[model samples]
Target: MQTEIIVAGFGGQGVLFAGQVLAYAAMDHGLHVTWIPSYGPEMRGGTANCTVIIADEEIGAPLVKHPKAVIALNRPSLDKYEPLVTAGGLLLVNASLIDRPVAREDVQAVYVPANEIAERLGDKRLTNMVMVGALLGATGVLEMNAVQESLKAHLPAKHHRLLPANYQALEEGAQIARETLAQAA
Candidate 1:
């Protein structure tokens, strides 16, 4: 089986990093994976996104017409990818940045206040991690431990001091998703 996910938002939102982390996790598990990043003309504060595909066998290509899942960190991304999620797929929205609600009933949409959650955790920059955690919580596509390990292996040494906070953000985001999903049950 294969899962294709797209992480999208403004450039500085760590979209590429988030996708890469997922790819790293897949690779660490011996799963075949591919990650492709797309950047807009403008850099930080501009549009940026990445597509990650994980499968049990060799991947044929990285291109996808409609992904199985999408993490939209901003309104523009939600607007552009909302209708592109395959039916019965997943859509994780950052409620802190997106004011509107998910319009697709065919997809399981989880809205997490990533920015607010990260801010509460002491760093708004950790929003991407929060969303990543939410996706794990909602779908279990990847194991939490693997992701944690991936972060530890790849995070720059200079930023290593923030590991505790980053881990906290992941748990907090996952908790939110668990609660939300429970309520909808």
Candidate 2:
């Protein structure tokens, strides 16, 4: 199985970090993974997107022109990357920031209030984790428990104490996904 994902948003939205964590989690699951980030001037308030490729076999390319999944944290991200997602793939949008919905029918568009959830969790920085949760729940790429374990491995020693918060954020995001999907169904 091959999974390509693009996490795109503004510069400070942790788009790159989200890709890194997903890549790391894929690697931990014994899959080949590659992460590519658009940096420098392109990251300044514009569409800062990172591509993560995970495959059971060798990955041919790291750049994802068309991804199997897209996590768009902002309106610009959705407007920019929504078309690139493959048919029957997954699209996770930050509903808190985007007003319009995806018009595509081939893919599943999941709306998650990641930023709002992070704010309610008392640390807006956990928006990335919240999106991670939605991604996990929507695509079943990684188990929730495995994601929690990966968080411990990914966070630095200085920020180790915040592991609990991140875990909670992820769980909350996943729960939101579940509820939203249920309502949509």
Candidate 3:
């Protein structure tokens, strides 16, 4: 099976980092993976996005015209990618920064109050990890343990102190998605 994902938001929202985490987890699970990040020169507050593709077999291309999933941390990102998600795919929206709902009915949608959840965990920067967790829980693309291990293995040593809050943010985000799934069932 193959899954293509796009994580998009303004710079400093960890959009690239979120894609990196997914790539690391896919590699750790012995899957073929590709990650491509795009950003403008404005850096922080500028548009930033990354594409991640994971498959059990060789991936033919790096760029995707339509992704299986999208994690949109802001309204603009949502507006851009929501329509591109494949039918029956997943769409993870960071509701704290996005005021509206997902308008598409064909894709499974998970709304996460990422910024608020990260703030409760004592680090607003972990908003990316939270969205990553929501995607994992909503789509079952990768196990949560795989992501946790990736976070541990790939996080810089200087920032290891933030691991606790980061882990918490991930769990809280997953819980939100899982609860949403349960309600749907």
- Cα lDDT tens digits, model 2, 94-178, are 9988999999998888888888899998899899889989988877777888778877897898999888889998888888888
Question: Residue 111 of candidate 2: its Cα lDDT?
Answer: 89
Give the C-alpha lDDT of model 3.
Answer: 0.89
Greater TM-score among 2 and 3 belongs to: 3
- By summed lDDT, the worst window of 10 consecutive residues in model 3 runs over 37-46
- lDDT-best of 2 and 3: 3
Q: Model 3, residue 66: displacement in angstroms?
A: 1.2
lDDT tens per residue, model 1, 58-149: 89879697999999999999999998999999889999999999987888889899998899888899999999999888876789899899
Better of 1 and 2 by TM-score: 1
| lDDT, model 2, position 28 | 87
Every candidate's lDDT: 0.89, 0.86, 0.89
Give the per-residue lDDT digits (tens) of candidate 3, residues 1-185. 88999999987899999999999999998999999986456346578999999999999888888999999999989999988999988889999999999898888889999999888888899899999989878877899899888888998899888888888888888999999989977
List TM-score per model, in order: 0.94, 0.93, 0.94
